[model samples]
Target: MEKLQLQLFLNIIGIGSASGLLFKENSLFLISDNSTYLYEYQIEKASLEKHALVENPAENILKKDKLDFESIALKGNNVIILGSGSTKKRNQRISYDLKTKKIENKDFSVVYERFKKEASLSDDELNIEGLIITADKSYFFQRGNAGNSANGIFILNADDSLVFKKIILPKINDVEATFTDAILVDTTIYFLAAVENTASTYLDGEILGSFLGRIKVENFELENTILISKINKFEGITLFKESDKEIEFLLCEDNDTEELKSEIYKLTINQ
Candidate 1:
């Protein structure tokens, strides 16, 4: 496979880079797995501001470290944030409004329990990292680790009831791979997965690099793949069509360090 290079267009400092990334007009929201605050990155001013989670009774739901939110997706004003499929902390989701800045708590425990039983995944091993919701409320989730070299992608179709589907990823570089985030651009689904040599179960370790897979949404089959070797474990991905000839991407990384200095980068994908 030919490695795709990340053209470092710009790097932003601070903001306590965490798991998910979502853009709303001129503002970009980044969330930390270890914190309750949602960071708003002002593109025009190039500054970041934090917003507290006001979930009424469970006001600090996101503040607790167990939530382990790993992915964020937007369908109009409904910003859906999902936690990593930790069996101990499974089935947690938040729906936040971009315009009104309102938040609602949601549960999919029934589906999750069925998923665990069907997939035979252990309580602490459900490691979901990627989430994408279509306009009609169809859900697409990417599992970070599914074993050694193989991983799985899950889909929850909308019909008032849920229909489940799982797809496996082919081994990349003959090693284990895990996904962090995903997005759907038109008819295509693009996800960023990494092969990090971590020592802990869900903790970030010595990252060896990453892979970006391009799949078609209609057939839900892998169409193309790009090996991104220079960047660390990219925890989130969002696309922007800057022009007819090129596409722009914003990726955020989690260093898993004490200081929480998350890095941001701009990748220009030539169309």
Candidate 2:
């Protein structure tokens, strides 16, 4: 593994609890777990746009009533936003059409139930925090912060079928790290994992650290893992740029605060 360098890139104001990130063209799309709006940031102009994804009675939804949108994936002109699926109320899926600028909401409870059954997971053991969509398959990451410490992934097919794969993630500071977000780049899958000392998926814990790692898509095996930051609870990641020498990634932090500002970091990995 080569050396990695990380730096503070930008502080995005007005967005809190940013859980998922997607970078397309010159704009960056972000979704907060507690907010009903999807944020778009113009890279060149440094401007921000808020697109309401759902009608909320309150400006920020309460923790138990929030959608808990934890994963964001792009397919064609459509952006898929998924909830953590840690609770019944969090099983809603939201999709935004870039071309149409329309929002569609679907109840993913049945799909989440299928996931729990496929993995033989308990109700608290099926927290999905990351998603990766390919040409024909979609991968969902199940964060193992809740029950059984069962970190896994679900592969969804075009025919609405699923295959479950159990993954063993490395521990940070003797605490097991759970998947927070992931992005597919070429043949490898880059992921962001964080260590929070919480036994329940619905509850917040002590933020120990975060890790940047990669896994082989062919075999679903971990290739490398590196400690990125010991303080920031990074929950979302997207590919910023790639070249022959190095690859840059933009990551959003969910500091677990009421502050309306979120920090985005640039991580460069040498090839």
lDDT of 2 by residue, 177-238 (tens): 99999999999999999999888998999988999989999999989889898888999999
Alpha-carbon runs more than 4 Å astray in model 1: 1-5, 9-14, 54-64, 144-150, 160-173, 198-201
Superposed model 2: Cα runs more than 4 Å off: none
lDDT per residue (tens digit) for residues 1-271 in model 1: 2433475543455545478787668677887776656678888898877666533222123433456777788877777777676655546778778779887767767666666665666665577777888756565464645343125656665655454455655454454566678888777878887777652345555667777777788777777767675447788888744677676678887766545466666666666
Worst 10 residues of 2 by lDDT: 53-62
Estimated TM-score for each candidate: 0.85, 0.97
Model 2 lDDT, full chain set? 0.89
